[model samples]
Target: MTILLWILIAVCFIASFVGLVYPIIPSAPLLIVGFLIYGFGFGFTELTISFWVIQSVFIILLFTLDYLVSSYTVDRRGGSRAAKIATTVGLIAGPFIIPGVGLLIFPFVFAILTEKIISKKTWNESMSIGIGTVLGILSSALLKGIAMLLMIVVFILYIV
Candidate 1:
């Protein structure tokens, strides 16, 4: 039973990493769920209070990075406030509205359109911001993936 539980935990960790690539999937919360499963399965003896607190902090940082990194990148690339806002809106709405591809594409499109129409930016400038938004999102996903790996390693250390 313990071995089976460990296998399940491994699956969850893999799924969380895949989620980082897919965008529509909720990777960070899934990682937290994985930790919770470990705690429950193993009677929580190894997952100390300090461990839980540290995991909680990582989870919070994971979610915040999704927003902060993208917005910061857009702003740094000369995106207007409206462009940033539109990118955020697209980030939230795209996955649900159009599914897999939308998650990757909508934010870029929205940022460009918002910059061009609302900010009166030329096409070249708007495109640059749009690219920045996409790059920022990708970078955040990469960082989150690394963090998830760290969390998994910590959990394994505690359990073993």
Candidate 2:
């Protein structure tokens, strides 16, 4: 039973990592769920209060990082507030509306359209902002993937 539980936890962790590429997967929440499964299965003997707190902090930090890094990247590239907001909305909406392809297409399209419509920017300028948004999204995804991996490692170390 214990071995099976651990294997299940490992599968969840792998899914969380894959979530980095697939926006709909809900990676951070998946990580917490895995931890909870471990806690319930193993009785949480090694998962002290401090350990829980630390893991919670990491979860919060990584979640915030996902948004902040992308927004910061857009801002650094001179994207307006509306562009950033649109990028975020696109990211949230993409996976639901069109699944895998939407996740990749919506952010860029939304950012460019937002800039052109809301900011009254020329096509070239709007395209530039959209490109920045795409880059930011890619960078944030990479960072989130790394952070998720670290969180998994920490969870395993504490539980073991």
Candidate 3:
């Protein structure tokens, strides 16, 4: 591959690593981009279209599975539909107002508000659910990060 191609792959790799920590950045997809560079642009040419297709299906499955796993954890931990909606709003709004810390606080505020409204829970219970939801999301993200890191290692092993 050309220098430019390799440069682009390098950029994707770095971005994927950033995604590992940054909640907003999508790490797994970025890793997939790097894999695509190797598989489609060069390295896997002799491996056949069927090979690439099968590999692609596997990659997409990983992405979907990670998503489901995280959301499932949040839902299983008593996160209600309203709580989820509010948490999403908080997550989006938090960053604009508070930046780094907002990432943790937004979902918390949303969960509390949602719990208060729908569940008619006391302040203490609302707060508990809020904290629990935040913890769930954080844990899910951590697990997903681990999975993404493993995918990155695989890509590096195969491509590099």
Candidate 4:
């Protein structure tokens, strides 16, 4: 049973990493969930209060930054709600469709075209949103990466 749970946790961690590329799955949240379950599911014998508090804060900050920074980036670049949704869908599809550069290139081109067609924006403004979507992805990833790093360091210091 312990071995099974450990395997499950590791699988969840892998899923979380994959989720980073596919927006609908929320990789960071899943990662934190795995950590939380690992910490609590076995009865919390090894967790210090400070460690829990630190992890809780890191998880909170991770999601918070991911959402705020990404959405704000889109909004700043003139992307509407529809643009975000379309970009997410495109991101998922692009990798399977074209592979490699398709992941980045497809989202950008799709976003630009969608904005131009749906929102009826000029080519220039539509292009701006494309750049913004990239910025949003980068910013959100950066913040999440930092939070995860902090959690890893804390976990090592406090538990392992």
Kindly report which residue pairs in candidate 1 clash with one another: none
Ranking by lDDT: 2, 1, 4, 3
Q: List model 4 lDDT by residue over 1-160, tens digit each.
A: 8887778777877776666665556776666676667776675666778777877787788778977987898898879888888877777787678765566777788789899999999999999999998888777776776677667666657656
Estimated TM-score for each candidate = 0.83, 0.86, 0.73, 0.76
Give me the displacement of residue 88 in model 3, in angstroms.
Answer: 2.1
Model 3 residue 149 CA deviation in Å: 1.1
Q: What is the C-alpha RMSD of each candidate to the true structure, in Å?
A: 2.4, 2.1, 3.3, 3.0
Candidate 2 C-alpha lDDT tens digits along 1-160 = 9899888888888898778767768898888888888889988888889778887888888879887888787887678999988887898898778877676679899999998999999999898888888888888888888888888878778967
Each model's lDDT comes to 0.83, 0.84, 0.69, 0.76
Model 1 residue 48 CA deviation in Å = 0.6
A best-first ranking of the candidates according to their TM-score comes to: 2, 1, 4, 3
Model 1, CA-based lDDT: 0.83
Poorly placed runs, candidate 2 (over 4 Å) = 96-101
Predicted candidate 3 versus true structure: per-residue lDDT over 1-160, tens digit per residue: 4787888888987887565445567776787687778666776754466545555665676567655754675566566778877877776677668877787788898899888888787888788778876776577667666666666665555555
Task: lDDT for model 3, please.
Answer: 0.69
- Clashes in predicted model 3: 0
As a TM-score, model 1 comes out at 0.83
Alpha-carbon deviation at 110 in model 3, angstroms: 0.8
Across 58-111, the per-residue lDDT of candidate 1 in tens digits comes to 888888887788878988989988887787777778877877667668889999
Per-residue lDDT, model 1, residue 111, is: 94
